[model samples]
Target: ISYVFIVENTGNVTLTNIQVQDVLPGLMLTGGPIAQLLPGEIDSTTFTATYIITQEDLDTGSVTNSASVSSEAPRGDLNDPSDDIVDTSDDPNDSSNEDPNGDGDPDDPTVTLVNSIYDLEVSKEVDELEPVVGDEVTFTIEVANIGNVTATDIVISEQIPSGYVYVNHIATNGNISYSDITGEWTITQLDPDQVEILQVTVEVLGFGDYLNIAYVQSSVGGNDVNIGNDEDSAEVDPICLTIYNEFSPDGDGVNETFVIDCLERFPDNKLEVYNRWGNMVYSTRGYLNDWSGTTNGRAVVKDSDNLPAGTYYYVLDLGDGSDPRVGWLYINRKN
Candidate 1:
């Protein structure tokens, strides 16, 4: 079967019952009409034609084909119309198409980076830059993914940036891990534009200024474009770091107390408690590590007089809010 494709009437003289040949395969010309023909006649007429073909007539697997036609008793027509038997193939028209995304052949598909969790970014308090000398402090860092494409296997890492020492454990997204020169914290992934949360902390030991820097990177092959970028869901938040220290009442049981008065008195502004057992009986949350006098849920008060002469574990929320400091302290019985 075939439909009208093109028509051309060039002769100056009009002829009745003209015929066309060399038509497409499986198609036949039933009839057509040409109004009139003049010296400059360029009129064209088209008609729908149809035909049939059997499996036996197929050119095997060659896929090539053609057809022809003839007419008599016609003035403007040829005896045999064989030119219509041009090259005809059974293949679809649109074969080789341009693949934009670099796949192959014509296809329908696309990909994108989605929901990514970046590395930990951080900021510091205007007052304190890093940990205090010989004192523990709280350091806070907020991670973000500032990349063009979403990244997988996002790994976050940090070093004490020198001048500062690790006083306690570091935390990221609320997860605590042992801090050292060789610690690699990782998050799921960060889309081109994603953000993550994390914190790095250290205590001030030696007297010097330290510059703290945290990094976020994609896990897949290094995409120079996505490295160290902050594209987290939320905006990159600022961090406030603090530094300080505190020594419990010198091995004394007399003034041994879980009070904030003594802890906030030192240059190393960290909270602490002196348990004769050299354990921090109490601590605070950075500038507010106020202990409620309970280990998770148990009371440490003995006879309501004072803490007994014994060692106890404690957590110190020291530093510049970049990291919460923790550890042990000693409490002695003051004679």
Candidate 2:
């Protein structure tokens, strides 16, 4: 393989440029632009040269590669003193150059991309902890990776709040975590285009509020790569865990349920649900709950009128009293 290399100075005052002919068999030369330079300044120039490379020349036995060339040249022409090479065989009187060092004709090198360029991405932000509270609200977290190489062993973790309690055990495929204790979560390995999910449950404690910093990191050895849980937090936030729930019939039906105005208890107090026997059945942080007049998933015994045509024993935790206020509820089903 044999080819000529060329360079052209197209920058201000003739910036540098190189003459390159890729000898890589699989590569196609893509043209580039020649920028403008100052007037009277040396214009960029490139040489047309030939080169070749063989598979046996590679140490790794890979044909993918790239080559570059740089040289100092004067203004113009082979005779220009600025040119590093003072020898010019283009002269008609030059007999030594006649046959062109020229006779055998074959020696070249090739250039190409290193190997492959890959882009990986994971959601940057997401609801880290979902299915919060007994059944109040859920969280969603997201992340993404975009780069030339594939990523592995990406893990996401979060700390449990002080007062709030852990609902479920952290589930992960393959990863190392701080501990197997409740509250902490992590994801092990995530290949290109692969995504891992973490689910956590929290019980809102007290009344004030709760926000904790969580992080997701890549298994990159060195330091941090983008959102790799480095700084105080490239991505950090305070989550206001206000427990809330509802039971307004989650389907296409107008009569299935009543628009239970729950979530209104945040300012009120813990709800104290009781059976006709005066036995407390359920309690909640917010009023966003709905009693189907049923024990668990089963229906509670009620008279046909549902009005109970009578009163049912119950207790209301009105925050005011350390003890619950007991009373009977009048069933008024709005048809």
Candidate 3:
């Protein structure tokens, strides 16, 4: 980086032996000392200095330096060397400590901020993409520091959509807390190339589509450059087991078979049908919803015979450690 300093003789008296000096080290100055500067005369000759930026400056995020100009007032006492006073004043352009009145106090300090990269990427995933009602789904949220500098005081915000209740959360390198449908994760710092993972578990309360979103809410030490990858979301669709009460298998093409909604979601399941006499007439493991009023159990019922139209009882075991669902099923053969 290069810096230019312009000194003007704003005083009434003529200034002599004008010299400019910068506080930063290793900055080469290539301007000569002005022999004399008249009153109200802006110096035509400019003082220029060049300095190379270092990695340390980028790490700190900014560089601040100031230049000072000093000259001999003479005070009409050129013959008397002791009476000639030297006046030094800092640059007036520095806002931190400007010296507009040419005061001898130390003041000027120009700040230059280094454009440090601050990028954070967030991604989310769920263990069960399609979950069943009352099932607990685990969501994984990962945050990575893809910038060149370390991010400090990072806070991540998480939102759990409706139809789900917060169970618990675990973070690898942060403090995770939640209230109702919102969650927060706090971290002291995350260095470049470092990553953190947080796992949040929620139980599906009702049957519906639920979307969970996570993003980097705030962070200090640097500004985030890329906002596109700062947030991520995962969706889970829960299915509820539904059983149809009646079906007509008369080859009318409507309600032709006993329909069980979401029954295929449970691979390990059993279905049993019983007549009014407490005799099991049909039973099968992994029922495929193909039972069309045919007798599949006892030899007395005749395997190929279609039972008369009547109301029967059914017991379905989902094999998921839950109690079996019992309900009444009606079969109609009337045209």
Error of 2 at 229 (Å): 12
lDDT (CA) per prediction: 0.41, 0.39, 0.78
Q: Which residue segments of model 1 deviate by more than 4 Å?
A: 1-127, 130-132, 169-181, 207-209, 226-335
Tell me how many residue pairs clash in candidate 3. Answer: 0
Q: Tell me the tens digit of each residue's lDDT in model 1 across 12-65.
A: 444333334534455566554443334344433444455453332221211222
Q: Number of backbone collisions per candidate, in order?
A: 70, 53, 0
Q: Point to the candidate with the largest lDDT.
A: 3
The Cα RMSD in angstroms, rounded to one decimal, for candidate 3 relative to the true structure is: 11.9
lDDT of 2: 0.39
**Cα lDDT, model 2, residue 66:** 37
> Per-residue lDDT of 1-335 in model 2, one digit per residue for the tens?
33333343333444333334444554445443233323345322433333344423322223433334333343544344356321111222323343333433222323332333233333323243333333333333333344334444555556555535555534444463444264344445444345544445555544323454456443542233354322121122323333222222323443232122223333565555455555544445544445543332113443321322234455556565467545544434333
TM-score of each: 0.32, 0.32, 0.50
Colliding residue pairs in candidate 3 = none
